[model samples]
Target: MRLLTRFCSSFPQQTTSVGARRGGINTHNTNRHYNSLNASSSSAADQVPVLDPSSLSPSLTRGIHVFNCPDEVGIVAKLSECIASKGGNILAAEIFVPHKKQTFYQRSEFIFNPANWPRAQMDEDFLKISTRFKAVRSVVRVPDLDPIHKIVVLASKQDHCLVDLLHGWQDGKLPVDIKCVISNHERGPNTHIMRFLERHGIPYHHLGTTKDDKREEGILNLVQDTDFLVLARYMQVLSANFLKAYGKDVINIHHGLLPSFKGGNPSKQAFEAGVKLIGATAHFVTKELDEGPIIEQMVDTVSHRDNLLTYVQKSQNLEKQCLAKAIKSYCQLRVLPYEQNRTVVF
Candidate 1:
C-alpha cells in the first residue's frame, strides 16, 4: 500500500512557552523512561537521572501523540522539550496547518523506557501541556501500554473482504484482535466462510432476519466492548439510531469512486458512464450515506475491453485491498479525523 502522509489532552500551570530547537532522531530501543511526582516529594530539579544513556536497550515501545489546536509559534519546540526532559526519544513526527482554518495539527511517535520514565507522570506532564495550549489530543502507547483494539466484523452474503481480513489477521499481517464475525443472513449460514472461520478458532454468529429473530438487536449486544465495527461487504444500511449508539468507529467499503457512482450496482454505473477509472473507497460510516471521512482509496484503469462483469470483478479486488488497508491503518492508530469530513492517514 502507498504510504499516505499527513495524518490528543489537558493543560496545567507552571508551564511557559519556552523555545527549544527541534530536530529529528531515529532509534530502535523499546525501553520507556518515567518518573513519578508522588514517588518523591523532592522537586524534579533536585532529583538526578540515574540512567546511563548508553546502557539503554535497543528495543523501544512507541507512544503516539496527536494534537490539534490553533496555529501558533513554539508549539513544536515546547512539545519536543517536554518529551526530552522526560527521557522520551522522538522517532517520527509530522505536522500540518490549514491556512483557511488556521489550525495546527501534529502527529508524533516517541520511544522511551518505562523503568526510567514513569507512565503516570508522563501523562500528567503531557496533560499540562495540552491544557496550556487549549488543544484536543490523544496519546497511544503501543505494544506494551495500549490495549489491543478489539474488532467485530459484520458481513453478509459477500465474503471477499471478510475472508481477506481473516487471512491477514491469521498471518499476522493485521495486528488488531478480531473478537467475532456477525452476519445478518435471512437465508442461512454460509458454510464456506463459516468452515474457514471455525478452522481458525474464530467465533462466527449468523443472525437471521426472520420474524422471530432479533438480529439487529443481537448485533448491537455483541458490540458492547468492541473498539470499532467493520462492515465488510455487509449489504445493509445502518439506521441513524444504530450509528448514534455505536459512535463514529464504524468503517465501510464502497465499490466505486465515491461522490460518484454511489449506491447499488456501482460497477454497473461506472460501466454505463464509460469511465476509464474504477476505484474503491474505505471510509467511516456517517448518517450522510457513503459521505464520511475517507481513510483509504485505490483505483485502477478500465477500458472498452471490460464489460459489466469484468468491471465488477476488478472493483471487488480493489474493495478487498482498500478496506484491509484502512482497517490496518486504523488499528495502528495512524488515522486521524480532520475538519471538513476528511482523514489523515500516516
Candidate 2:
C-alpha cells in the first residue's frame, strides 16, 4: 500500500472540526444481532436472496467511510486512490458538494482484504487522506465488525411509535441496542409494553416530571452511556439545559409537517385549516422545540371526507412509520446533520 502519510503531513494546517480522536477512527457498533435474534425469520425475510454477510469471502471485508471537508477539486480522486492502494474495491459511493456552503460530503462503501490491509493501517491510510483535505468530519464504519449502537427511547402516553420501534428492533429492522425505555406515564403490571420489555431484559423507567423537577438528571444518568436518545411521540419539551448536558444527538418524531402546524394538536390545526396534504416529520431534537433538523418525512393526501379522527389516525400511522425509518437510517449512518438545521440523508 502507498504510504501517503509523509506527503499528507506536509499540507499546511487548517481549522479542523473532525470528531474522531487524532490518530484513530470513529467506529461504532451496529446492533445487527436481529439477524441472529431470529435466525429462522431471517431466512424468510430474504426470500429473494442476497449476499449473506456471514458468507462474505475472508478476503473481502466491507467498510463504509463518511467524509466531510471544504469543497475542493480532487478530493474524490484522492479518496478512491487511497482505497485502491489498500487493495480495496469501491462497491458504492455518494458525494455532496453544495453551492452555498462550499463544502464536501461523501459516503463511500468498499470491500477489502484485512489480511492485506489490517484495520490499523486502514485507519492510518484514511487519516492521511482526511488530513490532506483538512476535513471537518472523516469517519469509517465496518458494520460487520462494529458493535450495535446503544440507545434509549423516551416516550409519553403515546404508544404507537414506541410499539413500532420495539417491533422493528425485535425483527432486526433497526440496528440498535435499546438500552432501556423511559416514559413519564406509568404502566400497569400486566401491560403488553411492560411484559415485552421484561421478557427481552430491557429495563424500563417511569419518571414523573413537573416544572420544578423535569427529572433530567435521573434521565441523563440512565442514558449516560447511550449513543443517542429517541423521543417517540414524547409530549414534554426538553429544556435547553437538559440538551446541553446530554451533549448528544436526540431524535424526535413530529406529527405534522414542520414550519407549518408546529405545536400540539397539529392534526386538529391541519384539519381546521383544510389542508390538502398532511405529513409526519422525524428530526433531530434541538432545544428549539420541534424546529430541529429533519431526517425523514412521510406525507399523504387529505380530503373533505376526512374528519378530525381520521386525520389523527392517518397521522398516527405516518408518525410510527416515519420515526422508525429515521432511526433505521441513523443506525445505518445515512443521516448527517448539516448546515442551518438541515440534514444530508444519503
Each model's backbone clash number: 26, 6
**C-alpha root-mean-square deviation, candidate 1:** 10.1
**Model 1 bad stretches (over 4 Å):** 1-59, 186-190, 210-214
lDDT for 170 in candidate 1 is 84
Candidate 2 backbone collisions, by pair:
29-146, 29-147, 29-148, 30-147, 30-148, 31-148
Q: Over the stretch 1-346, how does candidate 1's per-residue lDDT look in tens digits? A: 1112221111111111112112222222222223221135367666544445346576545677777677666677777788888788775566655435556666777778777777787788778888888886555454567678788999888778988998888898887889999887632345777777778787888786654444667888888888888999887777777877766478899987677877777788888889998899988887778877778889999988988888888999999999889888777667766655665555
Kindly list the per-residue Cα lDDT of model 2 for residues 168-226, writing each as its tens digit: 99998898999999999999879989999999999999998886888888999899998
Sliding window of 10 residues with minimal summed lDDT for model 2: 1-10
Give the best candidate by lDDT. 2
Model 1 clashing-pair count: 26
Query: What overall lDDT goes with each candidate model?
Result: 0.71, 0.76
Off by over 4 Å in 2: 1-59
Report the Cα lDDT for residue 195, model 2.
93
